[model samples]
Target: MIAPAQGGLRVTAVDSLAAGEGIVPGLPIADARALLPYLAVREADPCADAEALARLAGWCGRYSPLVALDGADGLLLDITGCAHLFGGEDILLADLTRRLTGFGLTLRAALADTPAAAWAWAHAGPGGVLPVGVARQALAPLPVAALRLPDGMAAALGRLGLRRIGDLMDLPRAPLTARFGDAVARRLDLVLGRASEPIAPLHQPAPFRRQLAFAEPIGTRGDIDRALEHLLDGLLVDLDQAGQGLRRCEFSVFTVDGGVQRIGIGTARPSRERRHVLRLFAERLEEIDPGFGIEVMTLEAPVAEILPAQQAALEGGPATGEAELARLVDRLQQRLGRHAVVRLEPVDSHIPERAVTLVPALAPPSHRPWMVEQPRPLRLLPSPELIEVTAMVPDDPPLTFRWRTVLHRVAQTEGPERLSPEWWRDRPGTRLRDYYWVEDLEGRRYWLYREGAYGEPRAPRWYMHGLF
Candidate 1:
């Protein structure tokens, strides 16, 4: 119900009825319905409104990187020198407003010497250009409430017959200070373009964006390749200033015909080195199709992380680096997608399969040793299957067991290594298991378990879980 710009309950939206059909923000739903008789209402969604604001902010980025969120429904772009790119300030503003209107957003825009003056006129006075000295005169005619004062302040001032900004502009500062406080004087100074109001833009937005204007469009990958280095050079400067290293990057080549081609590369370690970054991108250059001749190229890093330089000789190995190993890993990964090349990591668990896991290697390999103390099988089945065992229930290894229709009489047995159920995990679907390690007459070793020990119905349906 708040008009975020003025921070008051003011003219926010209206219905098709004559502009003053008694509809406005902060007019309670019940009261509005009583006044209008056929008032339609819907709950305001802060999330949907925020998403729309963010999309508008993205579009505003084309005008300037220093675009700050103005209010819940507005954006403030510090166009500065960026306006010259579209010719002049008037042409820039006109084009921007026209483009946004085409996209179904109704906007009220104003430009002045100061952000505060522009915002004030845009919020209160109708949208237009109030150049320099004319801004104060334009804003002075609007209601005194446009200074963004509180309800009590507005009502108190209204009661005193000072209903316009111009009415109070030339009043004695001492009298206003004694009654309305210093805040009133400061707000008035800001709206009159006397104070410097700094615009705090969105933090560290992507500055790697680059737009290249081409006189002759290049239709082949080779032609765009000549300009690719320059775009990457600009992006490198941005990355250097940001003090970030990239492990994964995407290059988008934009064509004159509104089509885009993207190429991506992932690294074995985070790197900001210009040569190393260029080397990673070099492998994918062949796939870039410059359809209808490319006019712009944008290089972006979607994933990055800190990579501290590692001393290779500290672990007692020769002083050779892992550059070759990293290169091989990157090659395999790029050809087969991320999941195709992986490293086996040891997990802390007693169950053989759970003891080890596969993870995609995105960074340089760590030299940590695999988990010790537990003997692991040469192979692990997808899931540990149930086995029918003739054993001393409650303890000890099975004397004989039936697995996969082949009843193997145990020639030698080891373990009731006493693997207990992981009940602490609250794994509702997991049944209790007791295991045995046994070697058959054929010299093949088998790992088997009983689903539940103390006798139950279906009498232990057996299965072959693993082989070693």
Candidate 2:
């Protein structure tokens, strides 16, 4: 049971046992308990349910690349050009229903030319295929709720003797529009196929993918490698003909025990070279375990980019060194995790802590140049470390300081560079900072700061901000 907006608990869902005892979704909890005293109930988890639905949608990709969530519980698959591959629409629907049912799911599926019509038929009629031109005939007997209108709107239609969809089909549009507004007419058109409804797939369909199903299951590592190489050969042909390069590829192995293991690899630059892609996957292929033997292999390039034709140099010189460097970076990232490889890029900020940031190694370098007028440190602390300092009363470089339990005597020093907090984002306790560069007697350079004005109610404090 889940709490409803009416301030009391209601049955959001029911199990087969509860349904058989005359309890259904939306019944009051008190009334349900009266029917069955020992009914088991628990609060619903919408987030977990949504995540499971998304995973189910991904799994449905084995049927069609275009699969979308219709509602929290339903799915929409656009199998326009894909029906022929699985025999026909009826066979495909049956196969989907049988497979999902095997996973302990109760499913209702219907096919029509429009999403609205299919949705209505799936909810109201016995699941079956509705031919292209028979949407009106198929939807005539369903209730007004099949049109997917607001609860208030459907109730209003019911009170006006418009119980069946066919009742509203022949009614004058102006009266319906005047009473219920345009939503009534719009939904009617959508259900009857006069208006078009498009399904937005959960994931964009990949441009290139190759799959191979073996006649017999093979668990050996050599067999898996051979299958992968075969799939890659077909995938590369498609990429080459389209003048494109693979940016990322996923290799999936489906085992006979109904489990899938996937290995994904990415590149620093777009590539179509077979040896390079295979080499990247070779490092991680051992991680895949072919439980109960592997039956099918699929290689898909979900990310790709255009690669314009290249011309050979007049002297047939060697390839660009930058390409080799990018390949090396890719290999290192593959061996190490992605976060293990990064590049430091300068950020456009005057504050010392916000001057530069870490970015992905393959990311394009920032076009802006670094500020060189002021001498900045080679390394900046994640946050300034507090310190005790003795200096002149007014604003002068520190004469002596103690940081991290160690005292340092100043040998040479620079001026106090004043920087105030951005006033547009003014907040309480925000204040100006005075930064100074100083060298200790041992030649260790340090960047220090004094927070706030010296004579404020709260005395200014010192901090060591960076090291050079």
Candidate 3:
């Protein structure tokens, strides 16, 4: 039971057992309890239900990459070119229904040329394949509710004795639009395949993918390597013809025991070099377990970008050196993990700590140009370290300071660069900070700052922010 309103509890959902006893959703809890004195009830969890639906949508990717959610209870699959891979539409639907039934789910599937037509048939017409160019004829008999109108509009149409979609089909379009508004005609047109209705897939489909299915399962490492090489060769040819190159590649091995093992690699830049891709995968190919032999292998380039043919230089140049460095970085990342290799990028901010960020080596270069006007430390601390300072004035650079319990005398001082917190960020109670570049007696320069103003009720605090 779920309380959708303040004063009453309602049956938002019911199980098969309760439904069999004439209990249905939208029934008042009082009436439902009266119908069955002994009933089990639990609060509804729409968030969990939505999460479960998303997981199911992801699982449906095996059938078609273009799968989308239709409300909370249904899914839409665009299997235009994918159905033939599983034999035919009928075979694919049967296999899908059987598998979902095994997982204890009740399902109704309908396939048509348009998503709107397919959605209507899934709820009203019997679950089956609806051939192309017959959406209007096939959907004529279903209820007007199949058009997915608002509840009030559907009820209003029913009151007018226009319960069946066929009744509205033959009526003049101008009268329907004048009486029920444009939504009625629009929905009707969508269902009749007169207007376009496209499904937005949960995931963007990869543009380039190659697959090889073997008649007999192969388990040896040699067989796996050969399959990968063949897939790479084919994928590179396609990429070359299209004038694009792979930025990220994924290799999937489908085992005979119904398990899939996948390995992925990323390049520093768009590349179509077959040797480079194969070498990156070869480093990790041994990690994939055959799991009772692999039956199918697929290579997918989910990320690709344009890479025009490059003219060979007369002699070795910086381009060759950069390519070698990129390959080395890729190899090291493959062995050590992605986060282990990182590059510092400058961020557009006045705060010292927020001035630069660390990103993966393969990530694109920072678009914000680095600021070189102010001399900053070579290394900034993760967080400021509080220290005690003795200076001529609270706002001035320190003469001596004790950091990590070591007292250092000031040899040279450069600045009291004033930096204020960003007011637009809406940070309350944060005050301005005056920064300094001070060199100690030992000739080690330090970046220090004093928070708040001088001679305030709360004495300003000093912190060592970075080292030079």
TM-scores, in order shown?
0.66, 0.78, 0.76
| Residue-by-residue lDDT tens digits, candidate 1, 295-354 | 556666767775444432432334344665665677777777778988788777776667
Q: How high is the CA lDDT of each candidate model?
A: 0.69, 0.85, 0.85
RMSD of each: 7.3, 4.4, 5.1
Show the colliding residue pairs in model 2.
none
The TM-score measured for candidate 3 stands at: 0.76
What tens-digit string does per-residue lDDT give for candidate 3 at 298-355? 7889999998877645433445777787888888888898888898898778987877
C-alpha positional error of residue 219 in candidate 1 after TM-score superposition, expressed in Å: 10
Q: lDDT winner between 1 and 3, please give it.
A: 3
Alpha carbon deviation, residue 164, candidate 1 (Å):
3.7
Q: Candidate 2 on 1-468: residue-level lDDT in tens?
A: 565637588999887788999999888888999999999889888889898888777667666778999888999999888788678999888877886887788889998888888888899877679987877877888999999997688888899889889989999999899988999899999888788887899978789988776768888988888888999999998998898899999998776655667889999888887777999999999999988787667799999999865653333246578877787888999999888899888876777676688898878876777876788888788989999998775567888999999999999999688888766654867888988999999999999889988679988888998899
Ranking by TM-score: 2, 3, 1
Give residue 291's lDDT in candidate 2 (0 to 100). Answer: 81
Alpha carbon lDDT at 116, candidate 2: 86
Whose lDDT is higher: candidate 1's or candidate 2's? 2
